[model samples]
Target chain A: MSIDTDDPTVAAAPDPEPDNSLGGIFRAYLAKLRGGEVGSLPAVLGLIALVVVFSSLRPEQFTNSFNFANLIGQSAGVTVLAMGLVFVLLLGEIDLSAGFAGGTCAGVLGVFLTRQEWPLIPALLAALLTGALIGLLIGLLVARLGIPSFVVTLAAFLGLQGVLLTMIGEGGTIPIRNDFINGLNNANLPVWLGWALGLLCIVGYAASTYITDARRRAKNLTVQPLLLWALKTGLLTVVVVAVVGYLSVERSRNPALTSLKGVPVSLVVIVGLLILLTFTLTRTAWGRHVYAVGGNAEAARRAGINVFRVRLSCFILCSTMAAVAGIMIASRTNSVNPNTGGETTLLYAVGAAVIGGTSLFGGKGRVIDAVIGGTVVAVIDNGMGLLDQPQGTVWMVTGLVLLVAASVDALSRRRASATGHV
Target chain B: MSPLLELHGVEKSFGAVQVLRGVDLSVQAGRVTALVGDNGAGKSTLVKGMAGIHLFDAGDYLFEGEPVKVTNPKDAAALGIEVVYQDLALCDNLDVVHNMFLGREMKRLRLVDEDTMEQRARETLDGLSVRTLKSVRTPVASLSGGQRQTVAIARAVLWNSKLVILDEPTAALGVAQTEQVLRLVRRLADRGLGVLLISHNLNDVFEVADDIAVLYLGGMVGQIDAASTTRERVVQAITTGVVPEGGAA
Candidate 1:
């Protein structure tokens, strides 16, 4: 109403002269829908391009369904731990101990279940508790002592490494013989179950997003355009379909052994954890406080948010998730030993998170970003492995990708602040 | 009338720089008390001390005509006092409703009660006459400066706030938005809130303030009714320690 008369400048020249061309308007809408996604477009496309390059380079091996399954199975533990690492990263903190912490948990679980004859469920709980306790210790040192997270966690990493070494007993190993634990690593869900689950998850996620968007829109919310929403749901559907399709086929060819089954249990567990973490981060008061602490500690403090508790909880969650990853890794390999923690695995987890576009400067990341980032890291590792790249080369390339992602995060942060968009 | 909040001989020093030197302030219910001073005139210090952000080194704070202690922000909040600092601390990623209930949320069955919070937040914002909000769910990042200020003010008010201290509330808003917020301030006073408005914008001060207490270099220069005092006199007291041509504390 005011546009017609109150602003003389807007009224003076206003004959609507095809203000937005169809193509321009369409393109603008595309750009808008791609809001934060724009910063990560390069990496997303890179994942695709890498797949193409790897498949062509080793068409016989890389393009095989078996190899693809192998890649997913192999990276499962890393990705799980990476997801947890993302939470710590979100607070602009580092958890150097996640790798060994998880490994220590594996040893703890191995001792409890395989040797002590504890049930797999209780044993796993004990392992998770162990991880959470480690995280709590780290959190206590950092929050109460006011020591930096990096320094504190670094010490925790070294200390946990020693503790793991001690637990496993001088390069000794625990052979996990539990049928249930082995089934989680070796077996898969039925193809129909996988497809049904995949479709259900995709539909559920999309519907939830749409419903939330509509609910907000009813409140006259400023929603991203419908096209953007469509694009997201569409892309999500494609990814789920592709993954389920790939997982449905037989990837094994041994006469005695079973043919490939379904998505690994770890993958299912990862998804469940992602959903839970996402809810905790986005929907809960505690999650909001984490963002608050990250965004402005002083401000959050003034708002009466218990900043220390938020930070401590993030660390606690990170390590607890790490413990879950450890349980998976121990089950997959059937042992906990000197190499249980794995070398540079924790660094890779951080690399995955940093590559996924989480800000090192904090207060500006999503759990989904970490999930996306974990997949990105997995894609690179898988692609490089298909090319028969050396372990050194894999680490080097991962480091480069991490650097690029960090740069992208920093640049995008600047752009967001400048445009006042974030 | 007796003061509802009193700061007697408050002093703040950072190293060798003493920002507030034996500053005295008195605030009462249902009135807008303006803290007027030049830049670096210890106005912020006095405000912080009053809001519990800073503890005065040598001051006795009297609340409701009795001496009280405020160790931190939580203590101040528990007493129904709120300070809207200059930066506001409004989360850019949060919406109006979320920002209003950021830390202190309505809980039911041990979970954040969405319905109760949303309804209350909507009411608080509506009461402020902030109709231009795009949505209560829109991230505060998209809000105009005035809208963001409205969110901060709403957050402060929604907490059952009694003594609302607004630090430079109209500093960056447009003329009309300033008028809107000033009116909101007036309504708050009418609700029997003790409002301590710290503003350099004398026009804004004159519009909403009931009594303008000038702070000049860590001292209580003078307290004058907005109805009786002229802008020239306030400005003079603000610039110099002495009140304009025959004013006194």
Candidate 2:
């Protein structure tokens, strides 16, 4: 791959490849993983180990379909909130106020819906707008005033908790009566609908991959072998279909409860969000700019990127996603209170992002890291509770897992840099 | 031919300390002009003025014989002038294509057209005969110093720059990498783009520069055709601000 001539156009093309077969691809992937391309591997492995250990300890409680569904529902709020934090974390910034900001947004929605008796859309809109404005204020302080994000968000954390307290008032809770909001956690899709949704996702993913591959081939670029693509798609399909089938099984012993066995609406919401956000963070130019800014703000500025604008947008997006998480939390509990979104909620969100593989050092992460990390946390919580462990035990296990995840991240990053693969 | 960029009596100061004082310099298309100076001789300040990072307080800044006021980097960029800073100004976390088209991405249907951008990046690198890179998708951090320098130069060239300024292009590079970069600079000039190279290494300055401009004590000492002068004369000019046999300033 050396250019020997002064005239580059006259240089001969380099050797192509030893193999373009399935075995070659597999070996390459193995080598890559060894070379520190271990994105989400630790989380996935942790998830498997949790399943094995928990099933051995409490098969009836942990392996039940109902409990699995509950785990997904429990993870929804943290997962969504963590998704927002992914953006901030990508820039190596922290939002200590994520939970409180979300709590305040939910409080706004609750007050408008119950006290003022407002329409649902307007109430939700007002909550989202309030979240955006909060983010804008924090972003302005960070970007315009040049305060470090950690300080600005820490102040917001305290201030927004106060806002939540005032909204709910002393020793009070607003019980949400809205059918749609409350049903977000309580309801489930029909079995057929759940299967159809899973099918849709699989088909959509495969189609996009095929189109990309075709485009690459047409351009005379290196394309992954069709067999390898099929293997990947087949593996994904099996996992998705298996999850759907498992969820579709009837969980209730009572003969009256016939339709409550499918995927929870909350799971669907989180998945939908996961898809939307993954697209935004991967396919869009805005997403690229976010990474660039997070990677090197000075370099980004030199490239003429409006660093202020990028940082502000990240804050706005994070707060807006946090607002959505707040709505989900309120929906699940049917109430908004002073205690909502406090007491380890923000810690879980940040932990979820970090444990899922998003770097605290910025510029290296994906939106899906939140999902993996959130699921891991939820499984630990669910499994520990099934083993008759106390909340403190669960906390310790979660903390240990978070520490392991961080060590994995740090080690992998160092290896990557050392190997010059970066 | 007339110089592509001409700076006449450019002056700048930070507070009371003047960094550039009435510096006159010109860069011709299809030629490499090396700007040599000592540590405090204001080479950086002069280059910054041309880059539009620090607008000259007093000067006739001309582009193609037309006087213009360049107050910012954007103004310089608008006139097809690109500066590859010594630090390279590359986000190490980003891949080569992203770094090449960082802020000004070629979008199709409002989305970053990665395919098109990748194609253009490949063409740009190929045009400059840079064949050492394994892939355009490789992150900047993985590249060797010489490859990184090439990426920086390729980025400057990709933007259709008429005058490309490189500051200390070979300072941190190994001997082989330095040779590769000097050749690339020669190729850039061969492509008819005006090149301003800033360096402390006179050996490099002599190897590739067509004309050499010496800066001493925040002022231009002389601008001499490189082949007509020797390293001792250039060193004397850089250190003493005078050519032994009366070179033109």
Q: Which candidate has the highest DockQ of all? A: 2
lDDT against true structure, model 1:
0.77
User: In candidate 1, which residue pairs clash?
Assistant: none
Per-residue lDDT tens digits for candidate 2, residues B1-249, read 899999899899999999999999999999999999899999998888888888788989999999988889999999999999999988878889999999998988888888888889989998998877656776776677788899999999998999999999999988888999999999999999999999999989999999999989999887999988888899889888887794553
Interface RMSD of each: 8.0, 5.9
The docking category that best describes candidate 2 is acceptable
Write out the backbone clash pairs for model 2: none
TM-score of each: 0.85, 0.96
Worst 10 residues of 2 chain A by lDDT: A6-15
Q: Which 10-residue window of candidate 2 chain B scores lowest in summed lDDT?
A: B133-142
Q: Which parts of model 1 are misplaced by more than 4 Å?
A: A1-40, A115-117, A206-234, A254-257, B1-31, B38-42, B53-72, B93-96, B108-123, B131-147, B170-194, B201-208, B216-219, B244-249
**Model 2 agreement with the true structure over A206-256: per-residue lDDT tens digits:** 999999988976885546767888998999999898899999998986848
Candidate 2: stretches off by over 4 Å: A1-15, B246-249
Look at candidate 2 and tell me the lDDT of residue A95: 94
